[model samples]
Target: MDLNQILAQLETANDEEIKSLLQQYNRENSHTFSFEKRKKACAKLCQSVLTVLGRQVQPSCQKTCLETLRILSRDKSVLAPVATRKGILGEDTQSEEEERVVVEALKCLCNVVYNSPAAQQVSVDVQLANGLCASLRNAREWHHEVGLFTLRLLFLLSALIPDLRGSLRREWRAVRLLREVLEHTLDVRWVGPYEAARPDPQALPMPAEDNERAMEVLKALFNLTLSDPGGEDDHQFRLIAALLRHLLMLKTETEEKQRKHTGDKSIQNRF
Candidate 1:
């Protein structure tokens, strides 16, 4: 179907139909619709999806709309609204459903910034940087998944916009939040698959995903420190200490496992 026809259908379609059409447009190898054509209709499609996101829709519907927005975010026209919408980044995101929407909105914004410097400018122009900072602060008390997603989005935006470093450092208080998260992760001894295989009785087991998220936050802080160098004295020292401690633990555990395996091999050989 043509872009106009699809847009027309979207105007009247229910949640399920809108989702199906959006999914069809997002398909990489769709014979019926071209991304080039869809690009022309991105503004309209984005508006429709944004409307869906604003309402009390099914989780599946919300997810589909979010995925569509991520695709549409390649266009600055579509991305600006996604980034700047107060509803997307607002304090109302306390429930799991609301958090999902906020996470998706941030992801869409992240995609736009990651894809185009022009979109980054749009984001800044629309004050998306401030909005993101607010969202980050709010998500700190939310589910860890939400917090991780927010951090990932912030990392992408800061990486793209050089000027954002100062804003995040001062206005947003990103460094403090990142440090807090990193310290929390450090306190929890993360015994993952490898640790389980080795069976370290001393280690406290944490979910592998939690450990992965913590590492991602640490990497984000490291990336931020690379560009903005002044504020890292205490934060950097603590981060490095935590990292070194974790590495040393891993090394000690691995060596212990290796020695035990070697001793078992030697005994078998002697027998």
Candidate 2:
């Protein structure tokens, strides 16, 4: 079915039918549906997913809807509907078994904001930075399955919207939260004897399983401070500088880590 017909079906379709129709669209034309074809219907199609989300339908069905959006978002022109939609990037997403639905939503957000300045702005207007920060609030409840995409989108926002960096730092305490998450995810902690902070590493390459999440945090930190006019004594600067001391202490088989690390050993090279 075309976009309009399928949307009409969504108004009355059963749970299984919702999933089947969404999946069929995703399979057949969510991609091939073309930008001009979807331009007018994009908002309706996006709302259809949200409408499905509003119902007490199966999580699988919600995921199908989100997955379809994720595919449709490949066309940046059609994302205004998605960009203006609040909660699309927020933390209230349904966290079912494995939090599949939540991950799917983040993936959609990543697709929406990865290159669209318009979507990025709307995401900021909706205060999604706070929502993304909420995802890391409780370490025990942290969604490990959703880690990469969450941090990735957060990084994109911080990078794409220069104006948002300050809010993310102050309003959300994002600097501290990101630091805590990096420590927790990497299982690293520094004890006693503090070392002065230093410059960030040029590259943070490591095994995908080992460093992907850490890399995401590093990339976000770079953007968060990208245009910082602050000096060394600045609070965000200090905290990250302190983090620099420990980040360098990590034992990595890669020379890039060793050469660029911020621990004591690098202090000698600093001067």
Model 2: per-residue Cα lDDT over 79-139, one tens digit each: 7666664535432445344478878878888888874777777787777788888876764
TM-score, cand. 2 vs. native: 0.74
The residue pairs that clash in candidate 2, if any, are 248-262
List per-candidate RMSD values in Å: 9.7, 5.8
Report lDDT (Cα) of residue 193, candidate 1.
22
Residue range with the least summed lDDT across 10 consecutive positions in model 1: 262-271
Candidate achieving the largest TM-score: 2
Q: How many pairs of residues collide in each model?
A: 0, 1
